[model samples]
Every structure is written in C-alpha cells, then in structure tokens.
Target: MPGSSILVTTDKESVARRMESLHVFRLKLLSEEMCWLILSQKAFTGRSQASREILEDIGRKIANKRQGLPLAAKTSGVLLQDKQGREEWQNVLNNVIWK
Candidate 1:
C-alpha cells in the first residue's frame, strides 16, 4: 500500500493477457522505495520482530533485487520473517536465485 492502496498482480505475460482479455486491472511497477516500505511493514511489524532497524541496512539491496515488485518484497519478507541476524539476511541477499 505505497503509492496506491489498490493491489494488482501482473508481470509481462500476465499484463499482455490482461490487455487482450478482460482488461479489468491496470499494472504498475512499484518504486524501490515503495517496495522497501512494504518489506519493512511485513518483516518488522506486529507479533513477529527482531531488531527492526536491521531492515534499513539490507533494505536497498533487498528492494533492488525485488525489481520494484510488491509481491516479490512480500514474498521475501515472508521468507525472512522467522529468521534472525545478518548471516540470514546476507544469505538471502547473496543468493542469486532469491531474486
């Protein structure tokens, strides 16, 4: 919920199909900052949290790797939610397949 509260899911292929078919939803690529905010909210909020400030250090790398996709950011946050420490974060960061 960064730029617009409305959520839509589409990549290149899905967008093309949407255009040709129903065209009900519009697809927009999120900004890196927006993705970062999303990941921050996901990983560091409510019942589960470690040091929330750690989000700042690894955030840029994480957001960049997500390619401004909210789904990607959310998925990544889920992957990391129960983990702790720089080692875990760095593992996610260094893994090319994580992208």
Candidate 2:
C-alpha cells in the first residue's frame, strides 16, 4: 500500500482518537456574513431586489441567531424558502429557539 492514502472525517473526538497517526484539522464556524450569504442563497434564489432589501435586516438577525453554524443557517433557509413576506421572516426571527 505504498503511496496510498485514505481520508476520513468525523465530528466526534472519540472516533478520531480511535485511529492513530491520522492528520486532524478542525473546521472553523461560519461568520455572520457567511451565514447570511448561505441563507439568502438557499431561500431567496429568485427574490426581487426590493424584497431582498426589505428582508435583509431581518435575514441578518436570523443569520446571527444561527450561532455561526452552517447547518443551522441551512435549516433556517429551508424553512423560509417558500416564504416571501417580511412577516414570515420576522416570525422566524421571533421564534422561541432564538430566545
């Protein structure tokens, strides 16, 4: 097995420790801007410029509540994908999970 390599990714420290001599690199959390970018890309693909401007502030708030987690932002984006109203986005920002 000369010049052969295998790459494995895991979030659990226990799993990572089971293998010796493995190179480990930790991933950094997303920034607020990055989270907003992901959410906007997922939820507002065809939204109008005016609509985007109207919702941008609330969207940033929602993105901030994601706590720099990409998965959280992606999930929120999916939840808002079909919603276009400011109230709908505001409702998400007001959700108890962010409390």
Candidate 3:
C-alpha cells in the first residue's frame, strides 16, 4: 500500500525489531500529578453534585493506583464517571486489581 501507515503500540522491543520500515516511538509513563489530572478530568466531566474536596482526595488515590499509566488512569476515570459517592470511588481504589 502506498502512502499508508500503521501504528502499533506495544511494550515489546522484539516486536519492533521484527518489523520493517517502521518508525518506533516509545511512550513514557505519566507523572503522578499528570495521572491525577487526567483521571479527575475524565471522572468529573459532567457531574456537579459531588464534593470537590472528597473527590479530589479519592481521585489522587485512584491516580496513584494507575501506576503512572495514562490508559489506566483514563479507564479508572471512565469507571468512576457514574459513581458519585465517596464509598464507590473508595471501593474502586481498593480493588484487588491495583494490588
């Protein structure tokens, strides 16, 4: 195919080595602050009834559990979108997946 491009995202170096004519770009993990920001943005996009202080506090804990991964933070944020209670967010933060 002419003028066609494919983007592959992977953590494996060997996969890139096996490919030809590829432009490989590595993505570093997000910082804790950035993770929290991303999570908060996605989680609180349309809600206003929740307490900002409590949400921010829980959001930080959830962000830390993301391990600096943007996808993780984004996914967690999306998961939290429908949850409006502190206990709900805390439950997500304490999930076994983060362990």
Candidate 4:
C-alpha cells in the first residue's frame, strides 16, 4: 500500500484528530453563491444555460435547503435534470423527506 492513497472527509474536528489524517482539508460550507456553480459542474455538466433557465428563482431556494452540502446540491441538480417547468422544481423543493 505504499503507493496507495486514501482520502476521507468529515465535518467534525474531533473525528479528524482521531483518524490522525496526515492532511486535513477544512472546507467552508459551499456558499449559496457556489451551490449553483457546483450544481452546474457536477449535476448539469453540459446543460448550463438550460439549467439556469429552468431553475431560475426556485432553484436558489432549493439549493439553499441543501444547507451548503455539495452532494445535496448536486443531487438536486441531477433530480432536476431533464425535467421541465417550475412545478417540477417546486415539487422537488416541497418534498424534503430525503427518502
């Protein structure tokens, strides 16, 4: 395992210390500003403007509910991908049970 590499992420500093992670990256919450950005890159990938057009105002509200989690934002984006209309987006926002 000399050349093998492992990376772990956590929100707790105590857990990080316990792991004795050689390198720690303390990341700030993904800003609402960047939530869309992450969604664009991770979820939408190729459909940028289309996403913006469909998402619009409601998208920001939905993205905010993710609470700065990149995975949540990306998941939202993927869930919205290929769907049309604000009602579709609104359904996603209103349904927050997280399955």
Candidate 5:
C-alpha cells in the first residue's frame, strides 16, 4: 500500500482536523526566508542529530524574526495561506525526512 493510505479514513471531519494540525506551523508573518531555510535543512538531513539541529535553527530563526515586533505582542498563525502557499508547502513535504 502507498504511504499516504495511512492518512486516509472514512471520517472526514477527523481527517480535516488532523490535516489542519499537520499543516499549520507556528510562524511569524515576515519569516518567509526563515521557513525556507528550515525546509531546506529538513530536506537534506535524515539523521536524528540533524533533525534536532534543524528544529533548533527554526526556533532560533523565529526568535530573530520576532525581534522587531512589540514586546507585548505575539504573532502566531498558519504557515500557508492560499493555493501558491499550499503548493510550496507540499513541495517541501515531498522532500522532508520522515524519521
């Protein structure tokens, strides 16, 4: 069976909820470049150590991206918005490490 078959089920609402959780990564509004950087790191390394480094890099980049924003203000939102964003996100997913 295909790998994607595991993600399929008869319950559409449950599937939609799962998809939403999987799709949305907490990201700052101006961190497009940082997101791409994380995506690239994730694409290259398959080892557990490399995975930790990639997550660390992502967290660090998000911290840096939040530097200019207000002290009291916190921005949290989905990583992808429209069709183009979804396409780009899927391209990243296609190259990711699945350990």
Candidate 6:
C-alpha cells in the first residue's frame, strides 16, 4: 500500500507561526527585504552588485533619460531593459550578498 500524504493548512498566519521553529522566519524576512531592494531599482539597468543597486540603477536611468537634445526618446527602451536587469540583479544581489 502507498503511504498517504497529509494536507496542511495554507493559512498565512499559521504558516508564519510554524516557520518560527523551522528557522524560515529569518529567511523569509531576508527574502522580502532583498525583493524590495531589487524591485525598486527600475532604472539604471541595475548592474551594480550591491543592495543599493536598485537605487543607483533608478538614478542612472533618470540621468540617461535626461541625456538628449530636444528630449529625444531613444533612451526609453533602455529603461525597459534596465527594469529587467534590475530584477535579475536583485536575485544576484540577494544570493551573493545575503547568502
């Protein structure tokens, strides 16, 4: 006979309390903070290797967006690319910095 798997409750509060003894609380907090830092860097291409990369990237993108005569829109695409890079850089920063 095959063993039956148990169905655990999917409640957020319950899950959080259970994670206290399992040591996942700290990990979750770190993950959240890292995610915030990464997602906030939707500029500058997020290429920096530090937690503040998002802030720096945002600043860079703003600067880049301002580099033009008559307000050319050539740098718009760079903003999109930088947004993606910011997400990736977040993961890298979290894994390398927090790990």
Q: Residue 52 deviation, candidate 6, in Å?
A: 10
Query: Residue 64 lDDT in model 6?
Result: 35
lDDT of 5 by residue, 1-91 (tens): 5756333333245655766545533334445554444434433344355544444443344334443332211221123222133345444
Local lDDT at 15 for model 1: 68
**lDDT, candidate 6, 1-99, per-residue tens:** 488543343326667576553332231222333333333334334355564444455433433333331112223324334445456544433443222
Model 1 lDDT, residue 55, Cα? 55
Q: How far does residue 27 in candidate 3 sit from its true spot (Å)?
A: 1.8
Output the worst ten-in-a-row residue range by lDDT, candidate 3: 45-54
Candidate topping lDDT: 2
Pairs in steric clash, model 1: none
lDDT of 6: 0.38
lDDT of each: 0.73, 0.86, 0.85, 0.77, 0.38, 0.38
RMSD of 3: 2.0
Candidate 4 clashes between residue pairs 3 or more apart in a chain or in different chains = none
Candidate 2 structure quality by residue, lDDT tens digits, 8-92: 6766767767876367777888999999999988887788889888988999999999988898899898888888899999999
The lowest-lDDT stretch of 10 consecutive residues in candidate 2 is 13-22
Candidate 4 displacement at residue 96 in angstroms: 2.2
For every model shown, what is its TM-score relative to the native structure? 0.71, 0.73, 0.84, 0.71, 0.20, 0.18
Candidate rank order under lDDT = 2, 3, 4, 1, 6, 5
User: Tens digit of lDDT per residue, candidate 4, span 1-99?
Assistant: 799977877889888889888888888899997897776555455666876677678878878888888888888888877667778878887995853
2 or 3, greater by TM-score: 3
- The 10-residue segment of model 5 with minimum total lDDT is 72-81
Q: Would you give me the overall lDDT of model 4? A: 0.77
Candidate 3 residue 25 Cα shift, in angstroms, is 1.2
Residue pairs that clash (backbone atoms under 3 angstroms), model 5: none
**C-alpha positional error of residue 32 in candidate 4 after TM-score superposition, expressed in Å:** 1.0
